[model samples]
Target: MSEEFPIQPKFGPFLRLFLHSQLFCTPQLPTQSFADQTVIITGANVGLGLEAARHFYRLNCARLIIAVRTVSKGQTAKEDILQTVKHRNEADAIEVWDLDLTSTASTVAFAERVNKELPRVDVLVQNAGINSKTYAVSEGIEQTMQVNVSNTFLLALLLLPKLTETAKSAKSLPHLTIVTSEAHHLAKFPQINTPDIFESLNDEKFYNGQSSYEISKLMQILFVREFVSRINAKNPPSPSVIVNLVNPGLCFSTLATRNEKPLAARIIGSIIYKIIGRTTEVGSRTLVLGASAGPTSHGEYMSDGQNQDVESWIYTDVGIRAQKKVFEQTMKVLESRKPGLGYAVGL
Candidate 1:
């Protein structure tokens, strides 16, 4: 494992971030209207994703696609957002699309629908993820690794063509924001020493559910870095699609307490969240900012509504090797699902 940072996963930085968010991290509402823009947010049925939908709606975005696993649940979220809108006519702007991250076919279908139906995609937020409390497998891989890492990028890569297409004709640069977490710093790099990190991580003997979640987030940052590099190298410079990652910091949400956590633990976590965690609305501000931020945020990891340095561990020699290895494995998995996807995205 790489040497731990003095500030990350420690009391000082955590406290500082908490205090800053409470006192200074106010949501910066967009001055420019999203009058004709199409915004798609996955896992938008609840939590920060739902709150982000509300923010986009407030900006009068033309098409707000709430992509969730359950169509009924998405409809409910859409209705909830419509209820909050001051004018009834604006309610028509919100639409629900079914997206199940665990299934590659479902993700492909969702992308196809978006390409055929939506005239353009101004923003795509990859926010659907879970921190599974127990070991489980989905689509023949560990659930956390499958949903948070592989499937997350699978969806992103599938949608790249649409984003690039939109940027070709649109006035504003298109944005693809991946919601990550500060927990990424907690990943133990030694666990991923093998050439095939994804397959190694799947071994039950070495499996640690929480650690897997952290590693998945860490991989997300690395993937964004490598992905942006590839796009920048494309001939003729593919339209200015800003690919960035955002950490919402500690937030008061049910993300961790899901999947049969003990009652006492849930109570303790709830109390801590109430005391120190930002509300979902406040935390979603960072997501909103990333989705709307300009060129400066490209390929950046943002926290507390600003660009923050990625942990030094990601820059180490070992870390760079891990990034390339994981990227290759990621491409293998994604390409197996949709043949020729990497070339389509100029990878």
Candidate 2:
């Protein structure tokens, strides 16, 4: 199975991408019952993740696990979500679990715990992410790349077994929703040509004036494409899980207002957000839609609750080659962290 999407006309596509900023109806789901599914949403303490979790609860998801770096904050968000959501049963459950994305040990531990305890992982939403303004390293990799690119996909790979297990036993297509963003369109990814993209990104000079976060997001897009291909190539009678990347459009994000950036840029961003940015609740519906989106949406990029094409260049041979490199290197790093992960995950 080739991972390449048909390239669209570069000039024609943007005019159609209304983004969440200009206008979009609140995504409404028909009354659906997730009365027996276990849904896990990371970064559920605040922002889009929190809102997405609330929507799943509203849909009557039987067991919800709100994974957060801070348990206290997760508890607060859990309470807020539980307040008005109608329940399926008094025995229905929502629990706050600890998951620190910044640490490899923590991420592995979280997934291990999930595999051990969770009866099923009906949907795994990879919502937790970071936008680091200054240069920093975690686990010897640049901090932003460490969490967003390396660890994020690591957790995804580690959890694949349980997800596939849920699929087989439940006879349901489990969802693995990885959060991406429109900011990837801004990523030139100048370091992609380097002998080692991840290593080049570690140089403080490369990140000094460059958009490290945006580049990381581009890596995410590439990673998903290649990952879907490898899994589908396994030649199962049918896919056990649906995996896709989602762009929530430009949400009114505090990360947009980081202090290290230019003053004029921040001012302009604040103005734009006021004029057009989406609220976390409105933005989060994409996550909900992505998780529920069926077979056709597998490996697609979802925007505004529908399958949307990515940047036109991504379908080109150059882009296809880059996609392979990113996923290969990402898998290399992840495997170094946890030997044999790629084969073990059926990738």
Candidates' lDDT values, in order? 0.82, 0.82
Model 2: ten consecutive residues of lowest lDDT? 3-12
- Summarize candidate 1's per-residue lDDT along 210-257 as a digit string, tens digits: 888888898898888877766777654444788899998788766865
Model 1 lDDT, full chain set: 0.82
Clashing pairs in 2: none
Residue runs of model 1 more than 4 Å from their true location after superposition:
1-24, 27-31, 235-239
Cα RMSDs, all models: 2.9, 3.9
Backbone clashes under 3 angstroms, per model = 0, 0
| Model 2 spans with C-alpha error above 4 angstroms | 1-21, 24-26, 29-31, 86-92, 208-210, 257-266
* Candidate 2 lDDT: 0.82
In order of appearance, the predictions have TM-scores of: 0.92, 0.90
Model 1 lDDT, residue 172, Cα: 91
Per-residue lDDT for 98 in model 2? 93
Candidate 1, pairs of clashing residues: none
